[model samples]
Target: MDEDSDAQVMLRVAAGDRKAFALLFDRYHASVARFAYRFVGDRARAEELTQDIFVKLYRNAKAYKPTAQFKTFLFRVATNHCLNEVRRGEYRVTRSTSSPADEDEKGVEAVDAQAERPDEAVAGRELERAVGEALQGMSERERAAFTMCRFEGMAYRDIATALEASEAAVKSLIHRATLAVARKVEALQAGIGPERSRA
Candidate 1:
């Protein structure tokens, strides 16, 4: 089967095409999950948030249009849904990252080792933990702007469009977010090991 452009898929979806809907789901579900995970710093909430975005898409498929990139439309919907959720204060969803009892019994060292390269795993875990903590520390707009720009690699114009802010404003959001996150990461690295410090 020929791969359809997202806009084409949406056009089909709007016409009640189940296959196109399935294709969109298959294409974006993971990205949505990761986007949520990066924002909320909780895997479970990330999963829920991702599902919620797709739900909105499914419900609104009839309204789909092709004036912009399909991802741009998808992100616009996703960003708005997340922002509304933030406003409703419903994201206080609670979950835990504590290791399962079975996993813990295996070995703390085994759990700590996450990278394929044995030598890199310990540092990688620490870095990931630090970044996760930093993400939790950010404001909603900062996190959204930062996540879209840094994680998704969206252009400034697209981000400004998605966010409905000026390019300058978008840049400011990303800059402030980067500075704040970088400071937290630097502080964390400083507290680790002298040999571990890259800067």
Candidate 2:
């Protein structure tokens, strides 16, 4: 279903059709749910928030404008909803994703990083933990920037559009986030408190 462009589905959805909404939901629900769970750990809350966003999409479909990329619009909706609900204490803050699939992914990345020395598995897990802790400590905007720009490999311009910030501001934010995360990882590796490191 992802093969279908969001704009095309959105156009149909905007015309008082439910099939388009169904297709969009099926196409996006997993990713949105995963993203929500990554941003907020509670499974129930993530499901609730993801559903609410889709509902909002349906209710607001008539106002859809195709001028912007659909991703930016969708994420903007998710981000704003997550931030607002977070502020309202409706969801629990969580670490980065830690699914069974993610464990397999680390195994794959590890294979690529050092397939010759598989004994580094423990060290790799430790490093992954350090990174996850660092990500967990970031502000929502910083997390969003770090996740979208680095983890998701989005361009700075796209990130700026998704985040609704100037490109320079987005760049600075990502730079700062990366630096903070690196410092945290270094502190963890060195067995030192993160407070003593550059942030």
User: Which candidate should be chosen as best, given lDDT against the real structure?
Assistant: 2
lDDT of each: 0.67, 0.69
lDDT of 1 by residue, 67-162 (tens): 767777777778887777777765642224534331222222212336678557556655555554455667777777887787667888878877
Candidate 2: give the clashing pairs: none
Worst 10 residues of 2 by lDDT: 106-115
Q: Model 2 residue 116 lDDT?
A: 45
- Candidate 2 lDDT by residue in tens digits, 1-199: 3323888789799998899899889887876775666567677778998999998888888777887666666777877777777777756565444664564442322112242455565555555555656666778788777777765556788778878899998888888878776777678568674445434
Clashing pairs in 1: none
The alpha-carbon deviation from the true structure for residue 5 of candidate 2, after best TM-score superposition, in angstroms, is 2.1
Candidate 1 regions off by >4 Å?
A: 1-4, 39-42, 92-116, 192-199
RMSD of each: 6.2, 4.4
Displacement of the residue 76 alpha carbon in candidate 1, Å: 1.2
